[model samples]
Target: IPFSSTTKYQISIHAMEEGYCLLAMKGAPERILARCSTICTESGTQEMNDEMMEICDRACTELAEKGERVLGFADLVLDNQYTKEYPFCAEPPNFPRKNLRFVGFMSLIDPPRPQVPDAVERCRSAGIRVVMVTGDHPVTAKAIAREVGIISYEEVIEAFNINTIETLPPNLPFAKNKAIVIHGAALRDMNDQELDRILYNFREIVFARTSPTQKLHIVEGCQRLGEIVAVTGDGVNDAPALKKADIGIAMGISGSEVSQQSADMILLDDNFASIITGVEEGRRIFDNLKKSIAYTLASNVPEILPFLAFVLLNIPLPLGVMAILCIDLLTDMLPAISLAYERAESDIMLRPPRNPRKDKLVTRKLYFLAYGHIGLIEAMGGFFVYFAIMAEHGFMPMQLFGLRERWDSESVNDLLDHYGQEWTYQNRKELEYTCYTAFMISVVVTQWLDLVVCKTRSNSIFKQGMGNMVLNISLVVETVVACMLSYLPNMSYLKFYPILFRWWCYSLPFALLIFAFDEFRKWRIRKYPQGWYRKETYY
Candidate 1:
């Protein structure tokens, strides 16, 4: 017979000169021992009495407690008279399976991989509960779980009273510090509510002698408690749970095709340590993505505020439409993409798993930091440069207000400046382009500081290191591109114009201010970790 979760054993028959002989029955020790009616003693087969059964059970328990997987073996010899009545064929007639002679026990030790203990410790430190579910006996499972550090020796001692609860109660006397080991037979009898209660009560759990169906139930029970579960398996019997879990990791080397197909991810090396590496990479990517988003969004205010000023305050547009396109597509692209290459600011595995519901990629605090804080300062920088350039050319900030209609009019050949200087349309148009260049320069400069400060949310730039070569190269490229857009000939069609070197110098203070302000914010957050400043402003 083939091995199954239900049968828990396999049998084979052989042809002998005397008759057909069933060579072996190998499976769960208890299941195989239960089917035997006679025991093979030193002299001959003897009736299996309660005393013999107790001795066999005790031996199996001892082996299992020693962290060995135990299997029982039994066989029977049939005479010619029995085979003659039920002749052997491709499909042999059913023969009596009872009264078989019980064989001695066999045990094998399979130690866990060396790195598994450290990986399990990392999971625990990360606040991820590691549960072991296996078809092994309860004692064997508990022993291995302890060896792997899933449950400590002290927890096992505390939970020894109810180590194997045959029946679950409405209210378990489970303490928060205690760990529990449950038998699969008891799990089979548990309803959904009782299973949920069991899962809720135990932070560390071990499920022994579990069937495929029981594994699926455990996955469902965790999901019902709003926990995100990731299950790993390598056998066909594991496919159901693998499919049901939020994330299913399949072992490529030993895993069945069915399990791999059902899994969300595959571990090619089949090492458990790879899973911790993946978690660290995932957290780093999430942090980098947030940094990229914040960097990208902060420039939106500087771009939009110029147009807003043109419409509401009736001032000449500080930034042109083409300039906004250049900022988004050219100067900002490389820096944002380079954030993905940034190394982790800290040991990401030391932090608890982020709450999916409460902690998001983009929060209100992120928006406030991007638009209201950093972006607001960037917009101010752009406007300061715009007005300074305009004032130098005889158009005062106050005089530029409510001048949009006349400023853009094609028919107005001459316009009066604050100094009463007359300017034709072409002259004023060149001045507008200069102002556009000035504002774009201010945005680009301030964002350089923005990118540096955004690299680490809680760590200072000096501590985080300015060592992302990709980002450093991107900043150099941004400066080159900005210069090209400003100084390149025939670029006026894009509303870009060459500005004096002093205009570049004017935006430097604002850029430094951005760096200084963000550094101060990070310092405050680090100094007073539990303060309201961190709660409200530390995005």
Candidate 2:
């Protein structure tokens, strides 16, 4: 018979000259010690009494307190008359187990990895609670949990004075700061409501001598309290709890096939520290996704306003279709992709996990900032450069208004300008393309500052620095591509024309304005974290 939590022991029969001898029966120290009626002494096998049993129990506890796992061994010999009637080989369970001679106890120690203490400390500082669950004796489990910093030694002393949880006062509130250790025997008597109180109260819990069913009950109780549970296991007995947890982690090297199949993720190294690294990486990816989305959406206002003006105000088109395509597909693609490589901010792990119901990737505040604030400013800057280029060519802003019909007509060869200058149809068409190129340049320039601002949500750009090599290279490439499209010769098929150097300089002030405004917004959010500005404008 194999050892199980229910039986707590394993039995085997061996042939002897007189009869079959049940030799080397090993199991849990307490269970095996219970059936012993005699002890093996140097003189002979002596009858075991209550005083001798207490002494043996104290020895076993002392070994367990030193972080050693203890197992007891015993043996019993069956006489030929009894063995012939029972058939010991076929009926192992029916074999005589009581009145066995107690041999001794065997203790083994498996120390935790050195990196576990530091990882547990990190989890504590990040507002994550750490729990220890094991099938070892309570003293051995508490010793290991204390060594790994799950609970302090003083807490163990204070909380475990009572033998069982039923001895505690019923009306006494469970303390959140105190740590508690519960035995599986006590858990078997607890109902769902009692289990919930334990899960909700203790920040650090050690469950010792637990069966597989008790582990599953703990996971279910936590889930009912709206907590996110992550369970780690390496045995077939752990498969049920691992499958029920929100994030199930299995050991790659030591984990059984049943546990691995039930787990959501497998740790190749079987180290607890790797889970911390996985958490930091997951948080970094989420932050970068938000940055990329914000950067892409902010340019929409500037791109759409030109066509709106062409329709509502009846002015010449300030930007062309081909130029808009270049902005979306060429100049903007790499910089947005580069945001994914941005380093995590300093406080990524310091904050508590986000609420999936209330906190979202895309919020109303994000849409307002992208469209109503930063996008509106970029649209104004593009329009300023467009009107500046047109006015320098003897076409003022007011004269350009309502000129869409004559501007596109092939029959109108001579178009009168604000200064009474007669312009040929071909000359006016070239000026329109120049305005298109200038507006596109303005959008590109303002986006340079937008990309920097989007790198962090709460930190200043100076603190974050421009340390990302990929984003810096992307910015340089974006500038080079925009300038090449503007100044390259024979590029009229793309509606790109060379513009004056001063037209590119016109958008610099607006780009600086964006940086200043975003810095001020970040400052306000940090100065008063609980203020209305953080709630309404922080995103």
In candidate 2, what are the lDDT values of residues 1-539, reduced to their tens digit? 77877677887766676565545589888888888999987889989999889989999989988888899999887765555345545344555678888999999988899999999987877777788888888888888888889986365522332245656544425453567788778777888988787777677889887899989999999999888899999998899999999999999999999999999999999999999889889889988988888889988999999999999998999998888999999999999999999999887777677766666898777888888888998999999998888888888999988999999888888888888888888988899998888999999999999999999988888999999999999999999999999989888878889988889999999999999999998888888998876888655
lDDT agreement of model 2 with the native: 0.86
Q: Give one digit per residue, the lDDT tens place, for model 1 in 514-537.
A: 899999988898899888668887
Candidate closest to the true structure, highest TM-score: 1
Candidate 2 runs further than 4 Å off: 16-20, 41-47, 81-92, 157-173, 398-403, 409-416, 423-425, 537-539
Worst 10 residues of 2 by lDDT: 155-164
For each candidate, give its TM-score against the true structure. Answer: 0.91, 0.90
Which pairs, if any, clash in model 1?
Answer: none
Give candidate 1 regions above 4 Å deviation.
Answer: 41-51, 84-93, 157-173, 410-414, 523-539
lDDT of each: 0.87, 0.86
